[model samples]
Target: MLVEFTALHWIYVVFIVLIIGFMVKRWDTSLISILGIFVLAIVATGDLTAALSKVFNSFIYAITELLSTILIISLIVAMSQVMKKSGINEVMVAPFTKLIRTPTLAYWVTGILMMIISWFFWPSPAVALLGAVLLPVAIRAGLPALGVAMAMNLFGHGIALSGDFIIQGAPKLTADAAGIPVADVVSASVPLVIVMGVVTTITAFIFLRRDMKKGTLELVGTYDGEKVEEKSENLLTLGQKKFFALLIVVAFLLDVLAMSLLKLTGGDATALVGGTAVFILLLLAVVAHKKKGLEKTTSYFIEGFQFGFKVFGPVIPIAAFFYLGDSGFIKIIGEYLPSTSQGIVNDLGLGLAALVPLTKEIAVVTLAGVGAITGLDGSGFSGITLAGSIANLFGTAIGEGTATLTALGQIAAIWVGGGTLVPWALIPAAAICNVSPFELARRNLVPVVVGLVVTTIVAMFLI
Candidate 1:
């Protein structure tokens, strides 16, 4: 169907273009998003008072939609902090360092473990979790600090965040935007993530070897030709260490078993992670610090909430704007305006269906570009709604799989803004590895660019 546009549709189009322009200029979008909602609401409601109410309602809607994700991330971080303090984290990974005595082994093993942990606990927590324990080991193994950083960066942020299979945060955002089920996007993301992950890590490994051969493997971080020890402050006994480690493994294993038997997925699975983290925090606190456990537990809550809200702050306004382009339109404006012809961005996107002669290749590449552009603000997720909305538009236009296209945009956004390309976003991994964020971004450019290209091409076939 050829879509017809109204004055409201035109306004939304203009707003979208302006939003992209602001992002391209590397400006924060909170003001622009709020302004967009203000103007869109005023025009839609035809009442200044009613329009003003929408701005607040929109943010509340966005927050409500995202609270579960924010909670899970915070809880996981708090759980990780306790694990680190209890020395369980060090014990958990100690066995791996014994097998990582060579540069190549150090690179592959660290990268693999980082990916696995990042998938479960997220890169924010996993960086400290993996880096503190494994970083010195990889460096002591004659692997350059730069090499270790690249391995951690690509596997954790690039591969794990891009797919987000365990957390489902990235997929859920895009899937919601595309008007599809989260499970479908997760299902479609596996192959694309694997393709991107394999190609990018392998390509990065080749460059690491090439640099090593050229004697460029010198430490960029703190390593200076001396043996290093694990960075730990906890003094737990060996038996205590093993016990906590075992406790953690069993807890998560039970969660896994529950998921399979209960058919838990998406938000349900995420709730399990969050709830388990909270329980772990309490148990570990009591076990590790005894009388000080109460104080430490409260402190963990403070740290986790601070970090969670900080990340959530930048996203709320941005997501509020796009949520209006999805189901949020009705929720935010329904009291005053009963319905919309279609969601604002959706209308704009679908209206262009016939205007642009889109082949599968063009559609995939364009959506990927949109996804990358949205990531310029450096939060992989805040921009996902746009990617999902555009995928839905393109899918409607071309008679293809909406989930596949949505997954493609999701991977692109997360890989870039999630930490691979953006210097500011790469700080966690870079700081832990003691390398410049700029250099890490520079190292990642080639492999990530190639991987995105390969993945986008593969998406053409799938779509």
Candidate 2:
């Protein structure tokens, strides 16, 4: 099957190389994306006004594909905000404090608990809880704040965020890019996520142990018997906290049950989760504030939107560029497109297939590298739409589940920019421990790199 190389195909390759180049230099991708759209549009249509319209339309199309995910994460973030204020979030992790009498226990326990809480609250709210309550305890246990940061980084950002089982925000982005169902991405990523999580967390723990043994980690020295206590003034009562936590657990259980019984996967399942978070949020608000719950909940919604849109803004332009190269282009600029009516990336992938004999191993590794490269911008979610797009491109070249490739890219993008490898994203956790974000990222480098490699290998076989 011989395919003729065209100017559009060459343009696609040049833009891709440029995108990766900009990423390597850690430049903001929004500008590159918009520039790519203009150049590609001009090459394809040669009309200035039409090319510019296509750029905005590409952004509109990408936002349409991403709106649901953005809303869900926002809703979950709002729920977490209320949960934290009400004290429901605290009750879930307070029980674990009794088990953290030793540094080793403190390190592993904090990571495990952070993973659990972040699974539900989506990390932002959980960071506050962990920092205020857990960090002091970990420090008291003689684990250097840096060690604590490493555990939280690997488990919360690397593992839980990579999997994103509860919220499904990450999977939705990858799936949208790959043009696959979110459930498929989630299902395919299970093995890879677990392997990545286990390998990275374990490897990090080994390093921490060595550092502790060598007394390389500065110890706070003495274990303080003084306890850090949460103020009960604004917090929910113990009964209210217990009841709300139980309520959330049962609601999630019902969601899982409904998913299994009704065979609701992907969007449907995600809707269920988002709707459940709203329900719980409303219930807790009313229980805590009665009629004023509505007013207070409104503020939470505002906060959630702020967080969601701030993150969403960076990714929109990036996603728009990738969308131009995928199925979304049809919606963006239909009549203006050439008669071929094929995606730019899919076309380039075909060209690659003709030009190079890339094996599955080589293709998977390349996709993984592309994913990591995208992560260099340090906002994990924004870069993944590109990963999803690239996964589709590679999936065409190599016969594998688009979900597998997409998930691999998602994991790689996240593990890097998600917080572990990115200095800025780690600020929340690092600030909590009063350690340097650069050091947090540095400590995370080896383990996360190993995890990415191992995860990519496993992803290759998931076909």
Q: Over the full model, what C-alpha lDDT does candidate 1 score relative to the true structure?
A: 0.84
Task: Tell me the tens digit of each residue's lDDT in model 1 across 129-160.
Answer: 87888888898888888899899889998899
Q: Which residue pairs clash in candidate 2?
A: none
Off by over 4 Å in 2: 1-5, 220-235, 336-341
Clashes of each: 0, 0
Alpha carbon RMSD to native, model 2: 3.3
**Roughly what TM-score does model 2 have, to 2 decimal places?**
0.92
- Residues 229-260, candidate 2, lDDT per residue (tens digit)? 34333657798788877888778888888989
Deviation of model 1 at 138, angstroms: 0.8
Give the number of the best model, judged by lDDT.
1
lDDT of each: 0.84, 0.80
Quote the lDDT for 11 in model 1. Answer: 71
Worst 10 residues of 2 by lDDT: 220-229
TM-score (all chains, Cα) for each model: 0.95, 0.92
Error of 1 at 310 (Å): 1.4
* Full-model lDDT, candidate 2: 0.80
Question: What's the residue-level lDDT of 409 in candidate 1?
Answer: 93
